[model samples]
Target: MTVVLLLCIITSQLTVVLSSAGNFWTYKGSLGADHWHLDYPHCGGIRQSPIDLQTRDVVVDQTYLSPLVFSGYDRVSNLFFRLENNGHTVQVGLNDKTMMISGGGLGATFVAEQFHFHWGAVDERGSEHSVNGRHFPMEMHIVHFNKKYGNFSSSVGKVDGLAVLGFFFEIGRFNEHFQEIIDHFGEIQFKNQHININSIPMIDLMPARLTNYYRYHGSLTTPPCFESVTWTIFNETIEIAEEQLVEFRTTIFENDKSDGGVFMDISDDYRPVQCMFRRRLYASHPSLKYDMASPRENGNDGVSNQPTRLLFSMFLVCIWCILPFFSF
Candidate 1:
């Protein structure tokens, strides 16, 4: 049988596909081309689906707040500011007092992991999925973990228990302000190694209309293809210069060129889009529309109210879902 692009490449194990676009490893197979779909022979398991996450719609009614304050862990990454808690790089903590509704899995405190970018080698047109059938320069995923689970391994190969924030990147000139992330790309020194990087702010890398993202329950689109996380993809596209995309991907050798005759040059690291599985979609949450639903008596024993580095406009909409779920 001919394998389909974007979806339909099926097997019992995860496959890592290396392309000029980047390196993507998948368990349920991956898309060969952009916007491709496939028959999901394996669906319905709690930890099966990879993309297009769906869950009970939780309505957030109360005001949301979290610490924009955070630090970066990786050096070569383009994430201007990121936060980590319980091994997660970017995360948020929400409690009942600050929460409002429960249905689509909102009001849960999820930790932010390392933020990264994806781009084409030459420039223009590397991301999956197009607007009105149009593709953009790249896509950025601000991955997160559900504090309810307590750890990544606990939530591993699992969905309905996590959240991932997605945003599209358009090609343009590198914003001078955006360079804060670009500045440190050289410091990372190597891949897979992490450090406690400081001073990066989450506010600088965000758009103003964070409340207006499309919410859905999707899989990690990575290995194990667990349909366990919630996705909030913004309708708006952010701009980064063609040169900026270049700068973002470029990596330096850990040692001096003279010390070792060969210092490896690295570039292009990203996870590709997985099968859509023709999954059903859900309606956006009401509290996100800035509507405060009828108040529930705030319980004293609930998630604590905390600020976030990248959990933009989210705490208010996610407070209610925090109390109902927990993983150890």
Candidate 2:
């Protein structure tokens, strides 16, 4: 009788441990990304995303990576969107089916599905995919599915099923376009909270230039970690005010208010850079100089001319000094 009771107690404890390990996941604590493989097998697989983009190692492929064509992104007057705090990250569901993208080495047209963000607790550590070992303040992913697959749901596991456009964010002057989305933060202060937004042009949220980017075949950054994404990480970054970043870090909670649990802020919700085993990162433009920290002027090469300007300034100073000595 004593042996049977002990055996039953051991069995119950084992069941509880397995249940907790399998169900939930988070960015930190025991259920963090490090332990995710216990529940999700693909999280530990090769071709995982959010790898550091070492620019020097990238292959320039102008022939295959032509400029991408955007369609229906500017249409906004009659469109509707759903913005929600989904316990993990803040996501915006794209309601318009007309918005689509093609080219830039993607063989098939992909219809836009939804967009979401990954951020850190502070301004310096938010972005998921880093450039030359530097993280941006934030990162945005615009997800799409191959038109041939019918919809995002049916396209989950195929090699060419998904195409995700990634853009990084930097601190700068106020962005009026992004302000439209930020204004609704109050309504989604808790998890599962969502609000419908009307008339926001999808084009306004992206950088003006869309030609230069880095492409690679990788899995989704989040779980189930499907190795189906054809990633196009733009070389240009979107700018937002520092105050707006604070609102993202502070305003949203991961748990619902009705749960009567300790409220956790949904910050630092990005996965760490994964290993690149045999994959090659490709650059769209051959001569494009990639820099995540510096600012680029509109309608010019992405490289900064600050060093050239400094050289010219020194030459002028030398000429000025000699002019006084050579006075006639």
Candidate 3:
């Protein structure tokens, strides 16, 4: 191992790049190293930002409970995103398997509690953090709750009970799976009222690479951007065509209904990058036995690491907005 590598291992702070080529990590953001306040209630002592991962501590964890199932789901109109009345918080219903993450140590379990997103102007990059100084078109956050913490209500005020995973969205081919959310984009409240639909399953809203990603600690990109979350970013990014991007912009209501589109509303939803602050980033690079690691999982295993678990990207933004959701 190299000198820096040994230091990282000794200090227990290391970050490794997945690679120069990947179907994953397309979600990496394009952000500047402007500023981040640790004392700010939004991101203080416990707050952490996106950190790269290296090959050291990664194992297949399948026995642990994962909350990305077809639980009960809710359907609410997104018209609220465009109105000028200071806008309301994103609405949510429920599902069978969705859960949240908790800071409960390395082997702790986290469930899907809620999901949300942050975007920016259609003209600029929308992700909150950048990778090697690169940004994507959009980013998704799949927030989870540590079962030990409590539900959405009990956990919000406290940090000990939650962990959030973020994924970047870039422009590419069309995504048929995302159409479900796109179809419902117009229902959210734009004026005084909109429609609320039935609950949906969590399985349908995720990318194919559920087990592949690089995880770390970070803060909420939105205001009151809490510093409580266990961020897991997938190496792969989902693809969306130009027309779909345009449709997304139009369907999503913005401050100016006549001008800018939905993309405009979410385009600038990103917050600036935060400081590394000397925190260590852990990585699971598999056993280092495989030639090229899986593009969609944190790392792959051969034998002893049976019952391998898949790393899922909480793709609940864009279509869902304040609420957790995926895109079309």
Candidate 4:
């Protein structure tokens, strides 16, 4: 019995060490965005993403920021999509080669790779990038890689390698197209879980108009925070029912079932707005205006001010380091 207990203790200790080490970054706690820079130097770089788009400072560029041309986005295919819960967010892989985008000042054609969402715990806030410091309930990012680089992985580090189309969500009537996605969430409720979705035209998930938008050079919001994305945030917001928003907040878990079956909700999977520095934010249309009188203007900019729990994390590390010494 003593031998069995010792073996069990060692196994538990190893599990704790591996879990802590493997998950080096997370949305909150000591390993959150504020501490990501310690491991990924680019997270601290000047060109980081999810900036508060202050409309008052935007530069109107209707000339070069022409209307984006989307090809094959509306085409319904027989190819199924893989929807997954990657622990960070729910992502849908769009492997179709036909789906492509160009124009809107993009020098080369870009092909769709995948799309994912970032949402808050409630309907009031969730979006990564806010307009005039006002956050929407949710945000969807359709990621595309520049065709010049050949594939998504190859284009990740290139300056002009990726273009991400961002759309905000507001509470309103039910969205049938969005429902198609939500219906599959049950299959991917746990981290690393995935399901195959029937083919649906990608256009169904987009806003009605794409002419009005904000553009800027930015980085991926996630860790290894590569400063390679050309961001296009739409002026129009997608409407979904309040219940649907709740479904998103409640349905997914960041932890797998095998990890003690702990229920950790995957909401608020977004990084706070980074400093814009000297970067220029551009608008496709001159008429796209924002309300300067937004509540966020009063200084509740939605950026988290919570101090990093570094000391606590170090204490846990020390415990893990000493666990092996306790064994025979």
Q: Name the top TM-score candidate.
A: 4
Look at candidate 3 and tell me the lDDT of residue 98.
Answer: 35
- In model 1, what is the error at residue 119, expressed in angstroms? 2.0
lDDT of 1 by residue, 219-327 (tens): 6554334667676666567888767666644553323334656644333223343444444444344433321222234662432232232243456557656756866
Of models 1 and 3, which has the larger lDDT?
3
lDDT of each: 0.45, 0.86, 0.47, 0.86
Error of 1 at 116 (Å): 2.0
lDDT of 3 at 317: 35
Residues 146-194, model 4: lDDT tens digits: 9989999999999999999999999999999989999988989999999
lDDT of 4 at 168: 97
Model 3 CA deviation exceeding 4 Å by range: 1-40, 44-106, 189-194, 254-266, 286-328
* Higher-TM-score candidate of 3 and 4: 4
Alpha-carbon lDDT of model 4 = 0.86
Scanning candidate 3 in windows of ten residues, the lowest lDDT window is 30-39
Which model, 1 or 4, shows the larger TM-score? 4
Per-prediction TM-score to the true structure, in the order listed: 0.53, 0.82, 0.57, 0.82
